[model samples]
Target: MPNSTLHPLASLPNLGPRTAWFLDEIGVATEADLRRLGAVDAYRRLKFQFGRQISLNALYALAGAIENRDWRSFNEEEKAQLRAKVEG
Candidate 1:
């Protein structure tokens, strides 16, 4: 069971129970929070909080969730762009 008022992160694309838990741990519990933080910032927070426990794929997932698309939908170029944002 889950709370009705708070939008579940798992309800978004590319996010599952474990990922939702991870986002919650990093203070992102809803779509509004994620939207406010944006994918790059959210991924950065996750990386800072979880370090190597988080992966590059989480960045794609966050972007996909924001765009309402699948994580795999991002082409190589887009992935590279995100990689640059993360590593830059």
Candidate 2:
């Protein structure tokens, strides 16, 4: 049988078993699935389901993983753009 594990997605922080299970329940079992939902929807869903705000740091991590960019190195303008993308 195939390995079946989502290796790349598993590397993201805070994406342990519980979060993974939540994502699966939301029909998002991979990085691509999360990315397809876009940042705003992803955050809203997570917040609503988990009953806690997802932090900017967590957002950065998820975005970085999806876009294959270094989120930590994003400039203020870039960060603003990301925030705008999520908020709008």
Candidate 3:
């Protein structure tokens, strides 16, 4: 059984240990924190902190987690939009 008190980000789909660690490094400890930061801003922080260590997939996963969807489920257009947001 899963721990009842696990951080929501830890339990979210498409996010794994590495991603959780990255989120932690960026000070995102709770679901509320992630929600407040939003995926784009969160990705920006990760990029700013980790630089080339972070990937676009991390952005996809963050967005998927926020929307309660799988990262792989994102269509090309959706992925493009995310890329644009990150680059914009």
Best-matching candidate per TM-score: 1
In candidate 1, residue 61 scores what lDDT? 98
- Per-candidate TM-scores read 0.88, 0.65, 0.88
The better-scoring model by TM-score among 1 and 3 is 1
| Candidate 1: clashing pairs of residues | none
Residue by residue across 1-85, what tens digits does model 1's lDDT show?
A: 2333234888899988778888888899889999999999999999999999899999999999999999999999999999999
Stretches of model 1 off by over 4 angstroms after superposition: 1-7
- Candidate 3 local lDDT, 6-68, one digit each (tens): 555778988876777788889997778898999999999999999999999999999999999
Candidate 2 clash pair list: none
lDDT of 1 at 46: 94
Q: Per-residue lDDT for 1-88 in model 2, tens only?
A: 2233554456665454555555665577777788789656775677677665456755665666567666686788878887888777
lDDT of the candidates, in the order given:
0.89, 0.65, 0.87
lDDT of 3: 0.87
Q: Which model scores highest in lDDT?
A: 1
2 or 3, greater by TM-score: 3
